[model samples]
Target: MDASDTIVNEIEKALKQLIVICNKYSLSGSLSTVNDLDNAFPSNLPRSTEVEFLYKNYNPEKLKIETGFTPIKIHSVSELSKAKMVMSAY
Candidate 1:
């Protein structure tokens, strides 16, 4: 169980969540399996490990930055096919 293993699990989890949100909102979007997750991502990458939210105030031209920590995103695979498998009555 190396780092990439954990990251892969997280990526899969995120993909599932994304698919759920898309279904809930009736959004059509999904990347192909190969394109969804690159095998190279598991290795050293240049992407950030956290999300940054920038706040700007027009009152006095002030800016504030907030960072939300998150686990590293190493890999992802499409969940569209899996999610669409669930039958619906409509």
Candidate 2:
């Protein structure tokens, strides 16, 4: 893969690791899907619709951590959808 692809791959790997860690800790936060990641930070194509869906579904106030790379939070479906919409727009 090219440099860009490699970076994307690395980011995916890191996200997976974060998810695993969250699961292990029994964290009440949900991890973003690959589609969500694309929308939140599109590489080439336009952002995916999934980002808005997530924002609308999840809540942001319950967030315990947000490192740009990873966000951990306790969110409802509605809040997630809203977050997705807000993030996708930018």
Candidate 3:
């Protein structure tokens, strides 16, 4: 087994574990979006424009370390709801 093969195996194992976790939580569906890069485990999130719910499980420190990427600004779902309510009031 080469380094690339080992990495692939690790990724596949991680994916299987993730699948089990998702199944346990009943989290399988188009409701989520999973973005993968370079065979790493994917970053999963709900596929909704609503900001409040979008960042439900987002952890900046963990994500940064895991993906080697800086976290982007994410609007909270509560903020989006308030904005909508304000707009409707007008």
Candidate 4:
């Protein structure tokens, strides 16, 4: 969800990572953190719809127990970014 701060932060971090990767390859690019919410969604769908969409969740406990596949645990943005960056390297 674009409205989610976590998602936004992850995107920002990913952009920064791309900059680093590009620079490593001698490429030039820029990243803008500004998120223009006005153009992010259809005008008919208000901001509240995004918030509700973000908050709506099916319980994850059952899936975890049944599948025995625990999701990656990230307590902070830094951890999430690091995990994603590491995963991306492969």
Candidate 5:
């Protein structure tokens, strides 16, 4: 319904995938419940004002000039897993 909702769902999906991989490989970890996260980080406040400002004022060209590295363009949280797969293959 919204960007926040999409991000939350994507994060949960990633956690579930991690759980499956951990179970298969006998690794140790656990997925926190949505309620747990909500309790820890209430939605009433902004998550990170600094990150928000950076996102709003992001400049790829400036970054490239300063760092000499071209950043990969990623539009959403759901695209991260796909991007990771591609990078690993590369």
Candidate 6:
């Protein structure tokens, strides 16, 4: 399913408090707001996968290098623009 569908399903399940999902960025322009809870989040927590995440949003034509991240074009807002799985310290 698409990002929106996944979000809706996950949000419903989130009410159970099984896990905490932190949506870092609204990569897709379609997601205007999340009704479940406040989307405001603190930045720069710390991680190792940042390079991979950055690569996804990286600009091409301007720069290029080996082991480059494949460009993920978001044709539609419903489509998953991007997603990052971050392990937070609880």
Query: Pick by TM-score: which candidate is best?
Result: 2
Tens-place lDDT digits, model 6, residues 1-90: 877666655654642332122123312222132232112221332322322222232212122122356743322111212222222222
C-alpha displacement of 5 in model 4, angstroms? 0.5
RMSD of each: 19.0, 8.4, 14.4, 15.5, 14.7, 17.6
Compared with the true structure, model 3 gives a TM-score of 0.33
Please provide, for model 3 over 46-69, each residue's C-alpha lDDT reduced to its tens digit, 9 standing for 90 to 100.
243222222333311211112247
TM-score of 1: 0.35
Could you give candidate 5's per-residue lDDT for residues 1-90 as a string of tens digits? 878667756665764665576567654333232223224332344445332322233211111111247632422222334545677797
Inter-residue clash pairs, candidate 5: none
Task: Give candidate 3's whole-model lDDT.
Answer: 0.38
Candidate 2: segments with Cα more than 4 A from true spot: 34-63, 66-90
Query: For candidate 6, what is the lDDT?
Result: 0.29
Candidate 1, superposed: residue stretches over 4 Å from native: 35-90
* Model 5 regions more than 4 Å off: 32-90
Residue range 1-90, candidate 4, lDDT tens digits: 344666656655664565576456554322222244334334443345423332122111111111247543321211233545677799
Q: lDDT: which candidate is best?
A: 2
Task: Give me the displacement of residue 16 in model 2, in angstroms.
Answer: 0.8
Better of 4 and 5 by TM-score: 5
As a TM-score, model 5 comes out at 0.36
- Which residue pairs collide in model 1, if any? none
Scored against the true structure, residue 33 in model 5 reaches a CA lDDT of 24
For each candidate, the alpha-carbon lDDT, in order, equals 0.33, 0.50, 0.38, 0.38, 0.40, 0.29
